[model samples]
Target: MSLLSVRSLTRSLAQRRLLAIDELCLADGESCVLTGENGSGKSTLLRILAGIDAPDGGTGCFDGRPFAWRPYPDWLRKQVTYVHQQPYLFHSSVIDNIAYGLRARGVPGAERERRVAEALSWARLNHLLDTPPARLSGGEKQRLALARAWVLRPRLLLLDEPTASLDADSRRQTIELLRTFADAGTTAVIACHDRDVIELAAMRRLDLVDGRIITD
Candidate 1:
């Protein structure tokens, strides 16, 4: 069975149709990139999939279960994770920011520390553990956001224009980290316009035009 499935999904804004997808499925361990022009509703789709926003109509299933987001809020909150294009970091140290989710979920202190350590090591931000995330560079901030999401061990990750505002070098670095995450087995749905990111292996492109998916 597909890990995730959506049918007849629709969303409207100001009485205008913003998105209307007939069907979509994500296989386990598969990664797909959502490509589209500005105002094509890419971010809206990601937000819906992330459970951050519910579609105005249609149904979603996760692992063969009724995954209508609102009714299964707890399940979605635990299993799905999201990172915005410009993620917000709490007004705190890097480690603390990364550990915030764990704390909110009531992960034990020792385990939280270990998970945070692993995330920091993977992001190569261990040296900046005590540094304020607000002081981080654009690339560093993006990495920190990735690390924060990485530590959660979510089944599916939704990213919205992760490298859009970054410099070339920083964009390259962020994309590499995303590739690494996908390689190591996290299901990712990325919405990006970066050409470098589209070439990653095992990544299927889904393009949206005029709020409709023309290719998948």
Candidate 2:
């Protein structure tokens, strides 16, 4: 079954058209790459898909149900997670940052600790658990961001240029982690321009031009 579906999706910002997608669908365990030049609304579309922003027209569905617009559904929020190009880390220890989601969902002490530990290990940030996120290096920050997202095990993961600011090795490792998520049945939609990310994702490419999907 398709995990996500978008039809005639459109968006505008400050009276300027930002994105207009005719049709898009992502199946369970599939990854799709959204590519476009700067200011082409790649991030805008990602935001819309992640339910961070609402489109001007058209409809979207998650798991075959009409997606709620005003006040996003709790169930949908659990199913989809968006990781920004520059992750926003709270003013807290790395462990706290990784544990934020579980805490929000009311997952208490023991299980939360276990999930946080597993996520830190998976993102290779186990050693940095006590360190402050602000004191971490760029790559470490990225890993922490991934760890924050991973603990939830979201069904539809939306990433915005996840490897754009990483070094070669860090980028490779990030791609591998994303692949691992996809293999484990987490559908991913990544908006990126990195060649390595595109190649490694092995996704159907959708090219956007001036906010419209031009090729797929």
Candidate 1 to truth, TM:
0.95
lDDT of each structure? 0.87, 0.86
User: For candidate 2, lDDT tens digit of each residue in 108-181?
Assistant: 89999999989988999878777889988777888888888899998988999999878888888888788778
- Runs off by more than 4 Å, candidate 2: none
Please identify model 1 stretches exceeding 4 Å from their true place: none
> CA shift at 69, candidate 2, in angstroms?
1.9
The lDDT of model 1 is 0.87
Clashes found in each candidate (C-alpha, N, C closer than 3 A): 0, 0
